[model samples]
Target chain A: MSLAASQAAFQAWLQQADDAGIAPTLADPRGLSVYQNNYRVSLMACLSEAFPHTLAWLGAEAFEGAAARHVDAHPPRSFTLDAYPQGFVETLRAIW
Target chain B: MPSPHFGPHFGLGLRKPHYADFLGGDVAVDFVPVDFVPVDFVPVDFVEVISENFMVPGGRPRDILRRVRADYPVALHGVSLSVGSASGLDADYLRALRALVDDVEPAFVSDHLCWTRLGAFQSHDLLPLPYTAEALALVCAHVDAAQMALGRQMLIENPSSYVSFAEDEMTEWEFLGELVARTGCGLLLDVNNIHVSAHNHSFDPAAYLAAIPFDAVRQIHLAGHTARTIEGREMLIDTHDQPVPDPVWRLFAEAITRAPHAWTMIERDDNIPELAELLAELDIARDIAHQAAADHQVPA
Candidate 1:
């Protein structure tokens, strides 16, 4: 595959590892799970970082559930994780 | 007036919790409880702000940054440069970043060497790149484009990764060295990242440090990570949510020995402690750098 194609495949796999499955070209597909987990955990942590007060108020389990739903609905579009939770307060209110 | 070049300085990431302290305004000191008593102030040689946070047209963030810039030299650190993207550099992102640079007049600008964006989707993570001649050429071209657009040199940071590419023809250090040689970009060597990647990939952190061109290093980052046991193997994840660990501090001392003049900063994005606590950590960095300078016979 071309470089662009390879990068696209890699990103897709990271975003939806179980569904997309690992890249067919990868030598060790199991390692992709580590990257996939890191990707989700980091993004979730970014949301938690941005909405600390909300997390504290909602507690861990509820906050994690809300954050997961929010992330599923709105995967980050910007390069900065700081901006990932721009409308999260409203999202939390709507969901709650 | 142009900002004074404040030689090599120690700084901390100007986090929101400490915004009022630096910006000099009314903030609820009781808002967050801490072990250390809340103090009105602490002095830092410089401050590093996430470039994207202030890339807005006009708002409180810009206002606060302008006030802080008046007092402290700010360094613009970005996460979205995505220099390794195969689709090419984002023109619109470059334009906004350049405008912010002109507005802020930061002491320097830096971003990670890894790519974060792919086509219209941004992963928001510093994804690793394969070390190959083709990748090197592409990154150099993108760096040149970024520098030309911004009218200033940029610093590329090393990223922590969980996996290595089988197609890589060279080590990441070699890729960075070649990149600096080709594009005149500097390095923002993150000691914690070096330690994390070294552990995850089973490479010598010292060897990685030795391979880098010391003179090209313009800044250093120190941060903490989360450790986990995966498949009965210990993996260190660059979480940046806590204080710098002992091993990272050791690597940082070694890093200072090599690049004595590079500005160093502590980064904490989550689980942030009191500003005073971070300042204490920065003090450790200062002491270590001072000792390393003496040992290496480099004037501090």
Candidate 2:
């Protein structure tokens, strides 16, 4: 596959790891889980970092649930994690 | 390209918890411990802020940054340049960053060397790149284009990586050396990232530091990481949520011996302690850099 095609496939696998599965093109598929976990955890942590008060108020389990739903609904569009929390207040309000 | 100017100094990541301390306010924030004293003045040499946080059209972020900028030189550390993307640079993002640079006139602008965006989607993570000749060429081109767009030389940071590619032809340090040779961009050598990537990929951290072209490094970042056991193997994740670990501080001491003039900062993104705590860490960096300079016989 071409470089562009490889990147596209890898990204697809990253975004939808459970459904798409690791691309056969990668070196070792076992390590893919690390990247996948980091992807979700880091983004979720970004929201938690931005809305610490909300997280403290809602508690970990509830905040995690809200953040997971928010992540599912809104995959980050911008390159910075700061942009990931743009509509989080509304998302949390709706969920609550 | 004109070399980015960053005089030798130590600073802290200007986090929100310490905003009132830096920007001046009576707003009661709960994240900061009550026992912690919020001083009226922050005497750091510079304040590094996430460039994206201030990219908004107009808001309190900008106002706080403006007030803080007046007190100390602000360095714009971006996470979104995505210079290693195979697709291309984002035009709108570049435009917005350029406008911000114009407005803030930061001491320097820097971002990770890894790509965060692919096609229309942004992963919001510093994804690793294959260290091949083709990837090098593409990254150099993108870095050049980004510098052109911003009308200033940019610093590409070494990202903490979790995996290595089979198609790799060279080490990351070699890629960074070639990139600097090609694009004339500076390096934001994150000591913590070097330690993290080295441990994750099984490389010598000192070797990584020795391989770096010291002259090209304009700034250094020190941060904390989380150690996890994955598949019975120890993995150091660059969490940046706590104080700078001892091992990373040792690496920073070694790094500053080579790049003595680079400005250094402690980056604490999560579980941010009081401004005094970060400043104290910055003081440690100041002491280490001072001792390293003396050991290397470089006049401070």
Candidate 3:
């Protein structure tokens, strides 16, 4: 699969509430779901790491929700996930 | 020197919640407790380490350092050193880092060889730099200056990159060897990172391990990584959100045999489980090391 196609597939996988039709009998959807949650969790952590002042400004719950949504929309183009939420301040500005 | 608290000298990332427990409880971790002492917290171990978080001035950073430095060796793990960038080092930032190093009297200080900025734009991520001669020269100069300013050696850690640079020269390990030669700095080899970078870049993991000087390695970092096959091209992402994976465990086993006395630690930056959970993982690592040592006695 091309990079774009696979990226879209993962995007679709992430968008699905439970990844309904994926990951057959070998691994449960629960494992995939947990992995999905962690993908978001790690991105939020990067948000907190990069924008601690933003986190302090928005508070944890709201900041987390916004960060997850932001990542969902902007998916990282770079290989490194270190700055997944590097544009968060601007994203927060656009949203709030 | 063997850490008084821990017998074997391997530790896990001391997250915030467990800080109070670690400081209050009598038990200590590893021979050298490679842990972080966050801003606005009391001192815990014989050493108070910082994550370059509170390595600033006139704010909670300095205040926290003042309180923690009363006890413990202060080692700084910085995320912004960008020792692999072609744009050259940030002198101002380095100067501040040097000042902080002096104040802490840290046992050692380190940063990733990944560039976090392009020009004036700072992404705040430990982004990977191209493995080229230009990149190597820029990083070596910074390492040399950082060592001179701090009046001590600086250890450079490998970065986990998702994509390979279009322009490159030599392997990452070769660049590391060259840097050591040019600057006389040490290495904080991240085992999981070796696995991650090798997976992403499609290189021989064993070959990468063999290239670096084992003696120069002062520390080892083991963290979790996530894998997702994006359109058939698999990508392994380093996400320090869970327990160390099994593959990393195997790789870590190989590492300890080579760098036997190297100080190692598990890094969990998010979704941090209970201290018991981390300790349990640490217990596994300890057990593996013991078994490995025991096997050597049988004469392989």
Per-model fnat list: 0.50, 0.48, 0.00
Model 3 misses residue A25 by how many Å? 40
Q: What ranges in model 1 sit over 4 Å off? A: A19-31, A42-70, A81-96, B1-6, B27-41
Question: Would you list the clashing residue pairs of candidate 1?
Answer: none
User: What tier of docking accuracy does candidate 3 attain?
Assistant: incorrect
Question: Predictions ranked by DockQ, top down?
Answer: 2, 1, 3
User: How do all the candidates rank in terms of lDDT, highest first?
Assistant: 1, 2, 3
**lDDT scores of the candidates, listed in order:** 0.84, 0.83, 0.65
TM-score of each: 0.88, 0.89, 0.69
Please, what are the lDDT tens digits per residue for candidate 3 over residues A1-96? 222232233335554543433333111223344345545665667778788887898899988888877876675543245446667767888889
Q: List runs of model 2 lying over 4 Å from the truth.
A: A18-30, A45-70, A80-96, B1-7, B26-38
- Tens digits of per-residue lDDT for model 2, B197-260: 8888889998888889888888999999998887777788888987898999999988888888
User: What tens-digit string does per-residue lDDT give for candidate 3 at B1-300?
Assistant: 232223335665555556444444322343113563333433222332445565556674465555445544455788766665445566777778877876766666888887654434344455445566766777888788778877878889888876554456678999999998888888888888899878877788889888988767777787898887754567777778778888889888877776666667778877887666776787777777677667665221
* Model 3 chain B worst lDDT run, 10 consecutive residues: B24-33
Candidate 3 local lDDT, residue B297:
52
Q: How close is candidate 2 to the true structure, as a TM-score?
A: 0.89
